[model samples]
Target: MSKLRLVHCLLFFTAICILLPPIAARGGHSDYIHPGDGNSSFHGIARHLFAQEEPRPSLELTRGYMTNDDLEKAMKDFTKRCSKISRLYSIGKSVNGFPLWVIEISDRPGEIEAEPAFKYIGNVHGDEPVGRELLLRLANWICDNYKKDPLAQMIVENVHLHILPSLNPDGFSVRKRNNANNVDLNRDFPDQFFPMNEDLALRQPETRAIMTWLRNTRFTASATLHGGALVANFPWDGTEDRRKYYYGCPDDETFRFLARIYSKSHRNMSLSQEFKEGITNGASWYPIYGGMQDWNYIHGGCFELTLEISDNKWPRAAELPTIWDYNRKSMLNLVASLVKTGVHGRIFSLDQGKPLPGLVVVQGINYTVKAHQAYVDYHRLLAPGQKYEVTASSPGYKPRTTSIYLGDNAVTADFILIPEASSRGKLLRSNCDCSCKNCGQPLLAQFFPETNNGITLTLVVVVVFLCFLLQRRVRYNLWKQKQSSRRSITV
Candidate 1:
């Protein structure tokens, strides 16, 4: 081999190494979406051919927006910086294999506690990237101010806040409204009145991830962010006849209350002329079937709201700061609402004072909230300044009802249920009252008016029996805990 030829070969290999890295990086980070990958249906082609094309701004509008990879890094960085109060995890992956990262913020991050859990999911529609940006801001704001700010501190100490910045990273990468498969995720959940999205096999991976997440984590309430409008929308997102009118769920008043919390806190959302008080019922605004908001309520036992934060979709990147400012308070207050104004408590059986994973029902609201299996704690969100008859019951136990006048602050009303065996009610009546007036107190101080000896004997026997039952119950629960592997749903 000639010396000159050897030098030329060395130069060629060096050039290949230098150029390949940049080419690979560009391919990995590019936001470009192939038209073929986006749509292949005849309907899609026909619509494109006949429909007039609307003017779309160049990618310049997304100049300051974080790419999918950048967003993933931001979440990781946040968790590291705020490791004391935050944990980073993923619900699932997008069609393009982008991790759906979630940032969980709490005083005790990743550890189960008797606290209400709330989630904020943004960027359901890829084009509506404002939510994703604002959600990141929300997490950062909470991290920065949790130590000094009362609202942030309360949320961190009392509630488990999960923030998923972008649910549709694939669509966002392409600046489209749908996912990579060209399906609208907001309309991809199971519907109450329709069976179109009832097939699990046909469900998108993004939708399935959300469904599985909810099943695993007991979210008390949640809200998704969007763009193209400015109003807080709450469920019955659809109707049986597909008509557009005021269609409400059984918890209409509660939903309205929850929606108002966001709209009223926004800088100018409440001043909107279109939606009254900057809030609208989903069906009343315009019926949409298989909406995530409705499915969250119906299937997941979570009250969810669809919030349209901006009038312009894909606004200039420079406007993100101002938009975040407008929504900062609304976001903080909505999370704080979980701990500030609600009915939260645990249920226990009188026999052994064991936590009973029972059902909590509020009178006049045709919905039942179940207590956490581990802690038996339930968080029921209700509008403040109202009287509610809360009833807690479990199988084989006598239900107890208590009236609470929920004021501006939250109320904790625990229940001690009695077994429904014959003569058990009469025997336990003196010690089985709920957290109402004179709870669990002896109605008869003296079993016999004349004999103090009889009352003393009765008390001694009851205490002995209760002590035995309590010991047995504790041992049984410990054995079950050792044998069974149960998923922990943070209260």
Candidate 2:
């Protein structure tokens, strides 16, 4: 053969050598001997490298636990049984289309009140079914004893308590740690430091439902139940640098106080040997990204804690009763803490005595607690035995600050904001009657004579039209002056 032909053949052989191994590997197992055939070391190494997750636990393991349908029935039954104080609602559906049911327990359920709100979420992880069971118990216990038990009665009357029994019903059915889409719901929320999970379209249904639910309801404090650990975990869940260290949010001390309420009230959570005082800061223990605990605090203005109630991820169904017994007081106390320890108040306008829907902020803390729009009520949770300078402010009004020595009980600190001088003049103009101030006649009635009934009606229409033009002219002048001022500043 010629030299060029020989060279071409050599290049083709080299290309075949480079690609043949992978092609043959994909073609058939006959090309390669199985590591499991004889060599124990190769078999072990291969198995370890490509190991799959453990099989989903059989339904037999969840025999005594309530299924998704059973939970829905139980929630509906509880609402029917205690219709006077409870309401059953669905926030949204899961990946598998299971309704995310929530039971609201309050004296005036479904009605917005000045009272603070609290929420408890169970079964964030599908395999950690303990919280879901315990939450049902919590609801029934309140329904059965609210008439006699003061704690239960207090929760029913003073606070709007929302309990979500299962956030990951799809995962719970399959006994997996993630939702039906295999996305970990806890880690699917938008992160603070990272832009990951910012696209709402890409978010999991479970996380989106939670984000939407929080937008509708204003919760002062909340907790989610999980297993495989026993402690109260609080934000900041993840650090900015992604390092494992103690990172706390703006209300770190207040969060610690809230977490301790659950830890100390528990039968033996505070006695844990692993976690100090059975309360661990999330980042201190281990930093995790996109956790719901931090997102609630940062975005929704809700203080949320991740409560690991059981050491075993999936304890026997027979042990659930004991687990509930251990956590019942803790859960109740945590809910009661919203009413017992916070600095609660309403913000009003001094001129009109109307609700201002203002903001309540403490002097030293960086966080701002917003008052409700309807009631203008604000619930600020703080550590007891501390003096705080609480300030309430609103647009077009002067802010008012008050200092209070909060004791063991909640303190009411209502604020009445005074309008600014310019704002007061505008308010006066807006509320002024469309009549002559000096003479007791309509402002523009003088322009027309009082002749017949037809002329009188015509005069009224003309006066109203003139007043509308005057108001529009006044607003346009203000806008013009504002634009002029901006131009001067830019120049």
TM-score of each: 0.79, 0.77
What C-alpha root-mean-square deviation, in Å, does candidate 2 show against the real structure? 15.0
Pairs of residues clashing in candidate 1: 115-491
Per-residue lDDT tens digits for candidate 1, residues 1-491, read 59999999999999965553111000011111111222336324422322221244478788989999899999999999999999999999999999999999998999877788999999987878899999999999899998999788778878899999999999888877678876778767877775666567767899999999999999999999988788898988777776678999998888899889999999999999888999988777766665799999988999998888998877888999999999999988888888777888778776545689999999888899999998888889998889989999999888999888888877777787877755532443345423334434553343454577777756654764466455544644542342122222112
Evaluate model 1: give its TM-score: 0.79
Clashes of 2: 0
lDDT scores in order: 0.78, 0.78
lDDT score, residue 208, model 1?
Answer: 96
RMSD (CA, Å), candidate 1 to true, equals: 13.9
Tell me the lDDT of candidate 2.
0.78
Per-prediction CA RMSD (Å): 13.9, 15.0
